[model samples]
Target chain A: MGRRKVTHQLISDNATRRVTFRKRKDGLLKKIYELTVLCGLPACAIIYSEYKDGPELWPNLNEVRSILNRLSELPVEKQTKYMMDQKDLMNKMIQDAEKKLEKEKMHTRAMKLGLMAGSNDLITDTDCSEELARAADVVDKKLKAIRERIKAVEAGAPIIKRD
Target chain B: MQSSNVTDCTMRKRGTKRKIEIEKRMTKQQRSVACSKRRPTLFSKAADLCLLSGANIAVFVTSPDENSDVVYSFSGYSHASEIVDCYLNNKSPPKTTINPESAKFWWEEPDLYRDCDDLSELRIIEDRLMRTKKHLMDYLEKKEKSHSVSKSDQNPNNDSGSSSSSSQIASDFGQNPSTLSPSSLKIVSFDQNSYSSLEPSSQVTTCFDQNPVFSVGSESSSDQSRYLVNEDSGFVDGLLCETEEENNGMRLPQETQTQPMFTEEDQSFWENLDVDDVFGLFKDDNNLEVPLQDHSSTNEDDELLIDISEYLSEEAMECPCFS
Candidate 1:
């Protein structure tokens, strides 16, 4: 009857709790459907009434479930917005990673060049094979770094690239 | 008539009061209170959805009902154990953990079963991991041995020690290389449940292997044909062609660029699709079949009504999926 703060411990009035639940539950399911439509994600909601024997659906729950289930087919309305934002982040990460790898490779390359340039005939740093090995090391380090990042997903094995 | 209207008013007044009483039922103060009250009902709806859609759902309801009862509902004719299996495995997804697939492994190796020896015990886990590490080390040793023993001419430079490195690298290089590459390079076959990759080195950097790797098949055009249809080189070649085309107005040869034939993915999509699932793109067949009538037949020629059916059909073909 009056706008008072509701404690949620238990509705002190018996008849009021039932009424409030019915209205709020319907609204809850509606909110869920709206979210699924707008968000395009798989969401299965369960509702159990305090008085009722079991949980019950609002409506159109099946259509919503199926839509969410076929996730790949579902138009990723989030894709465009998320792509723009995530692209910047992911590209930044990639560039950062690439730069880090480049620094590592340059450092390795410089070390190998120093080794070759400074060698007085200890090991055969004197051949094309050593040059190939140096290039191979840089590629190997870069690829391993990338592989570790990509392996975050389940997909396995990477295609090799020759410089 | 006045008396009847009074009686009607009483009835209407009573009905209105009853409706208002119903509205006073559920709490709507804070968002969390609303969520807590309505969560169970939401789960119930989700269970119904799973049943109606014939989708396997294994729900791990983080919260309980108003009475503090945890309820688990799977699809019809499924065991509680299976549903629990799906729930505990937690592979459903990060978002949809509320719904999980049935425990029916689509395809898997047989004879796998849980041991009664303290399945949840930390000691067992530690022991299993230790055994795994030991096996891995042994495997690496064997691989290094094999790699060193490969064709005498292949790695004539490196001491035979690299043979074992090659063998160890073979599995890691082939298996999970992602700690590094986002490019999902896979060799998939319909018969195989998943890619049964060869053992790779633990490091995952064998892709830069000095020597090229090739797969052989038994008496099949899949491999060793006079014209090698190298799936790996094809990707590089495609990239190169794309780059060349971008720089110099040229395209990959039409023969090499034949679009992939229909695949199981397309077939699976069709299988999942219902007969009536039109996606609502087609307007009507009557419009398609109806020929454009000549309005100039009975009158002098003014503006010619071009038959646009051909254009419609042509546009329809370009619509890849519907066609």
Candidate 2:
């Protein structure tokens, strides 16, 4: 096992605070310095602590007030929804299509196996109870496709079945 | 005395006005207008700082919806990727070995094969599958019976099929009935030993008049000989229409055929049919496809506190009913 040695570096809080204030102040000024420098305006900023005096006072206080105002103003809430029905409908259609695709495959296999050709034309040609037979044909065609597909796939490899 | 009283009233009014202004300054709502004014100044100052100091600052503000936040970043100036890199470099964890039962065994590069514990699932599946398949076969047969009679009923001339099957049916001697499995090579015999609950006749009868069938044109020639020839003059036209329908089906790819909207289909079906006859035929018969009505309504905040079992049980249990 390899253990690495640790090193400690310390700076006094008062010193760090002084350094931080100086750095942040410089940074803030550096932010505004561009505009002030370009405009060549003699602008000075003075920040007075609330803890120091009975009455609070700041010089070039408008800038500090503006910064504070900007920070405080931000929007929070946004939009959300469930849309359960549309989601369910989409899922159902997907399932329906999958089932149909499988049946068509199976029917084709059965046909190849010298079985009956379960073509939808069976209903149309018959001049049957038109709508009822048509609907049945739709279901039959869907089932046949699914079965043929299942058989072909199962013969070759793994077959995934939907519950 | 009158002059002194006037001076006192004027001073009191001025004091009240100053108090109101001070109160406005204390409230955040009152400060909102000032805040609006300050935001532009802040943006300008930030842009100026970037241009002046040559610090590559990137400030982004996102819509409140997302975790994508306002990022005021600098590549070298502020920490971004460097902190994560430091954290990662500090300690390297070894990969842990997976348990044999875990799904990871299937995903790893090396093949670690194990027999599935639930071999019983196969038998259960096989049983269900056989039942379902039997149902399907029965449905198809029922559909075929209904299909033949339905056509003959609609257009009586259609009875003169292209083959001798009809004559054989009318003869009433069950000497050579239709093959149990239309496909002769491989037949899945219904085993009477295991489950006698599933009857072929029961399954076949269910499909009658409920679901009709359609055919593809290429398959027409193969089955035309199966139909019995007719003595009537109208029989020839019926066979021709069958061929034409088969051709129509052949023209469109299965999925691409755009199903007409209900209003459109309803109109067309009514327009083509002898309304009295169509209604007469289906008056007592149950339909194959019972359309399920859409329950969704355009309602806002129609929230109901339903029990989990009533609404979401199908999905939580992974049951097929919901699907």
Candidate 3:
């Protein structure tokens, strides 16, 4: 019969623990070696077992240290400073939005107060729409003027106005 | 007889279903044997993956012994540390997120955000003012230069009309005359000295005078120069350039815009990997097995004769999805 499936966990029994440790450790190293060879990747694993006085280092200690040293030498930005700058930018944006909201609120309040003082009558949708329509007409006229000026500039017309 | 066979089969099934209880403790011999077996298996798996997908890995495990810590290291390359370094180097600089230290309670908060917002708005206003001023200065400089040059080329009788039109054009470009004072004057003087230093020859000056639009776009051109230096100092330039691009309606090149997105994609790949998932691939029974040759044989021949091209390519194809 096939041996029972192995679940990865530590062994508590002294004899079993020692046996499992040796088998698993060897298996781990073999797997590492196979993966490194088959995939053509640079890989290393360091295993220290209680059974051995010295740790089992694949491809040796000097090489691993050099790899680690090269990693440490890389220029990565300081995490703390990066976080701080982000926070500052976000806070600034939030504050700007808040100020804009406050200004809008104050403007609405002023408009309401002015209307109340000017007349006892309430403002209707028609009045608001008429005012908006007038604003839109003015904006459209300005847009047309800007467009014409741009076209004139493109055509190399001599400048007539100073402002 | 058939009933007896069925009962026997049932008993076998029950025995197989029984949980394989592993002892909590192990003897010294068993631990040694297990460690030796597992260590080799781990290295082999690493080697396989490395060959298949061109991945680099380093595993370092420290086990506490009776006397001292035992260090076991497996590496795909000759030097294990190099792979470790490669792994570390690939990491993106810490992402900019919330900083708890800078956060204050509502009562303690100041008007710094609004102040910053105003300052930024002022900067944009200042920048536009500077551009207009630069354009005016260029026009003035050009007019003087053109007049001097055209004196020989064209009739001096028409100078009044042409000079008037040019001055009008320069003045028309600016919305507010008051914006010319204060910091803009400082920028104009600074720009003139810098511009003069860059092109001292009369020929270049005449060429610049011909293209007034060039001076209008000089702000972004100057910023692009700063961008090269900003790359060395983290992503502040990136943020600045984005805002500038929005204001100017300019689009950065495709390569530059797509680069960060690619790095972010890679970040997800690394961040999502767990230790269990990493080793689970090796434990897969269905995977193709490569024969474990003696280490001595491999050492004797510096090069491996086994051509894993077919298997490597197949595995390589599958790597990106898993990674």
Highest TM-score scorer: 3
Best by DockQ: 3
Q: What is the C-alpha lDDT of each candidate?
A: 0.40, 0.37, 0.44
In candidate 1 chain B, where is summed lDDT lowest over 10 consecutive residues? Answer: B238-247
- Tens digits of per-residue lDDT, candidate 2, A1-163, equal 9976522111124454355444544565553343233332222222221122221112244643442233234332211111112233346457878999989966764454332234535434443344445456777999999999988997896777799
C-alpha RMSD of each candidate structure in angstroms: 38.6, 37.5, 45.1
- Per-candidate TM-scores read 0.16, 0.15, 0.19
Better of 1 and 3 by DockQ: 3
What DockQ does candidate 2 score?
0.01
How well does candidate 1 reproduce the true complex, by DockQ? Answer: 0.01
Q: Each model's DockQ?
A: 0.01, 0.01, 0.04
Rank list by lDDT:
3, 1, 2
Stretches of model 1 off by over 4 angstroms after superposition = A64-163, B1-323
Interface RMSD of each: 16.0, 18.7, 17.7
